[model samples]
Target chain A: MSLLSLQSVTKTYGQGQAAFQALAGVDLAVEAGDFVAVMGPSGSGKSTVMNILGCLDTPSSGSYLFQDVHVENLDRNQRALLRRHYLGFVFQGFNLLARTSALENVELPLLYRGEPVAARHAAARAALEQVGLAGWETHNPAELSGGQQQRVAIARAIVTRPTVLLADEPTGNLDTRRSHEIMELLTRLNLELGITVLMVTHEPDMAAYARRVVHFVDGRVDSDQRNTPRETPA
Target chain B: MIWNTLLIALREIRRNLLRAFLTILGIVIGVLAVVTMVTLGNGATQAVSAQVASLGSNLLMVMPGQRLGPGRDSAGAPSFKLADAEAIRAQIPGLAGVAPMASSQVTVVAGGQNWSTTIQGSSRDWFHAGAWKLASGRLFNEGEERAGAAVCVVGERVRKELFGKQDPVGSQIRVKQFVCDVVGLLQAKGQSGMGRDQDDVVVMPLRTVQRRLTGSQDVAGLMISVRDGVSTSKVQQQLEGLLRERRHIADLEQDNFNVMDTRQIAETLSGTTQVLTALLGAVAAVSLLVGGIGIMNIMLVSVTERTREIGIRLAIGALEQEVLLQFLIEAVVLSSLGGLIGILLATGLSMVLADLMQVPYAFDPGINLLAFGFSAAIGVIFGYFPARRAARLDPIEALRHE
Candidate 1:
């Protein structure tokens, strides 16, 4: 069975006169430990696909299966549980809570999981260190550079040791050097921890870090290709 | 869960100290006004009741008029004489004591010091009927009272003004044209419920005030005390009937004199204070309601302001209730803290005002608890809609929100 699969899912926004279809009959499957990148134009529904996979949203029609369980039928709380236990998200904005320290930001997922403070602290510390931020644990987002803040966001995403990491435009706000550094971190996390990394990037160079790339056009997938990734940054 | 929510609430409050302080100030002023009004109201009521009670339990004042109050026009009615008091003492079966009371406002001079005070004239029975006790010395001797002698008992206020610290009991004071020796010092009873000074007086023999001061045989009023275990209302009815018969009032005509019950007077006076307190408390309640609306307004803006934060939390895995509880508890903690501060402030303010008004400082625990409970309820009521708005936001749309 596939790690996660979407079977001919269709999603529409609005109603009647102003209705707009964001996704039309999209079929996708992701294997465990695979790094797949989704690329599309601005209005091609790539982020919608990410939202559905992250369980922050559900498709308007058709089945979403995770490990042979139908995700479409899950209630809101159940979906939240799925997201909490199995998924992590990285947004373009690096949505770390303002004025919160890096370590505490990483500890947020564990806090929702109701873990003990000592364990959460230890795990958050390890996750921050894994993101190459061992001594920057106490720095708040405003105090950190954009690259460091994005790194903190990535650390926060992986702190729970999630099965799949969904990153949408993770390097969108960073310059080339910072973007390459974040992609390298993602590559290392995917290869070493065997986490399924599903990313959406507008930049071809950022997408080159993924082993597989899927391109979308006009709200539907137009191409899917596999390649040997550029493992080292220029 | 509660502890974590409380932590989040405290952090939010600390992060936005100025906004929180503004919200809290609204509640503080509201609660402070409410508590102070209630506390002081209760104190004034208690003071009134005490002052009325000090006039002697089950006491009645028979004023020589059909009408009562500020514009009491008693000129059309004949004043009561000492014979009326004697008649009431003889005819009323449940009587404890009676005094024929007459008074004249006079300037009393002692040594070089002079003070203007009321000189009340009545028999020795006036002590029991008017609830007067000797703080020092003694009441009139048989010769002094029976012969209408030139002797008097000076109340504490009159003594203070006329004789300073030296004992007035052995001193002489000039009333009108004649000098009278002070044979006793009456204990101080402070002020009456009507704001009249009870102790600012000199008590002389009835005939001395009638002959030497007023030059009349007429008494101003009758002071009567009912015996213990007797129903004062029943005695009042009997006293009324006896006076009607003595005054020769026709069966169809209204009686010339009016009977005033101390207990009834206490109820009326306290009722006035209670009404005033209710008015003030109502004003305060409106203020609290407005303060609650202010909280709602702030929370609404806060929910809007922190949409992105909420999006982040929801994305990470905060349940709807978690987000809801965070905001709700924040408002609760802020308002409740405001209530606590207001109660403390009200306590201090009420005490000071009570002292200034010369009323007892009465602390009511129920009111304090009720005020606290009300503020917390305000939190839950006003905090709900904004919290619900926060919880119901779409995570994707919220994330996209700038």
Candidate 2:
């Protein structure tokens, strides 16, 4: 069974003639240990798809089965539970809480799980170390380099040992070298940790690193293809 | 779960230290003012009540008419005299003691130091009637009062002014032009019910004051002290009848005097003070209400400012009740802390005022506790709406907020 699946999901905003469709009958599925990249142009509804997949938003009409449970029917609290227990998210903006150290930001997911501070701290340290950010736990997001902040974001996403890791333009704010470095880290985490990764990116070069590429246009998937050579050392 | 939320709240408050301080400041000042006002009011009431009680209960004072009667005003009005006091004492059945006194405010000189003081001359019974107590030496003797001797007893304030803690016993102080020997120092009487310092004076023999100070044979007022468990009104009636018979006043004519009872005066004064304090407290309470409103304003602002934070917590599986609880607690803490500070400051201020007014310093635990409870109540009352607003915020919309 797929770890995360969206079956004909659609999201609409407003009403009557003024109504807009942000996601239109989108269908996608991500299995365990799969690295899927969603590619799209501006206004192509890739962000809308990401929002739905992460459970940060709900579809107007659809059947979303997360671990065989229908996510589209889940209540707000249930969705929060799914997000806490199974899914993790990394944003392009390195959405670490301002004024918080990297270690504290990484500890956020554990806070949602109601873990004790000591246990949360230990898990956060382990996650940061996995991202090659050992000993940089005390540094704030603002103090770190672009790639380092992205690494911290990635660490926060996987701190809870979630089954799926979702990244929305993970390297959009980084330089080419830093972007490649972050992609390398994500690829390593997917391969070594066996965590499914579903990422959104506009760059073809970045998409090439994924085992599968799903192209979205006008709120629907235009094409889906498998990469010929997905394994490449950074 | 509670610990986490509290930790987060404390952290946020620390981060926004300036805002937190500003918010708490309103509560602090409000609580402080309320506590201080209540404490001072309690202290004042206690001091006045004590002084009134000390002057004796169910006691009546018969003062002379403002206008000279009988010989000057109406042909029927009788005059107040020392002889009237004697007649009242002899005729009244329920009477305990009766003492007539002549009083005047005059300059008292001891060596080069001269101080203005009220001088009262009375018999031996005057000590019990007016509640005067001697600190050193002895009270006036029948020998001194009968012989109209020149010996006198000075009050604490008068002794302090002239002698500067030195013993004034065996020393002589001049009352007007006549030198009177100070045989004793009176006890510190503190402030009287009417806000006057009861200790700033000297007491001499009634005959001596009549002879030397006024150069008149008549007394100014007659004080009748009623015995405990006796009906004061009955004694007053008997005294009035006797005075009329002694002075030969005709029927259908107004008596040339007013008999004032200390207990009645105390009740009237106490009621008046209570009304005044309540009015002052009501005014102060308005500020507390305003402080509660201030707390509400700050709390509302806090909800708005921390909307995103609320969203984050909600998204992470926090209950609406939890969010509401957090904000409400913050408000209560702020206001209650303000109340505590106000109470402390009021205690200090009340003591200082008591010293300045020459009254007994008093601290009432009940009033302090009431003020503190009032502050916390204000917090809860004002904090509700803001906390509700925070709890009702949509997590999705809040997350999207800037």
RMSD of each: 2.9, 4.1
Write one digit per residue (lDDT tens) for candidate 2, span B53-115.
999887888865423324444443444677777777776767778888888889999978989
TM-score of chain A of each: 0.98, 0.96
Model 2 ranges off by over 4 Å: A14-20, A39-43, A116-118, A145-147, A203-205, A227-234, B2-26, B65-79, B243-256, B290-294, B316-370, B377-394
Candidate 2 chain B worst ten-residue window by lDDT: B66-75
Cand. 2 TM to true fold: 0.87
- In the predicted model 2, the residue pairs found to clash are B28-B338, B32-B342
- The list of candidate 1 runs beyond 4 A from truth reads A231-234, B1-29, B69-75, B146-148, B325-358
On lDDT, the candidate that comes out on top is: 1
DockQ of each model vs. true complex: 0.54, 0.33
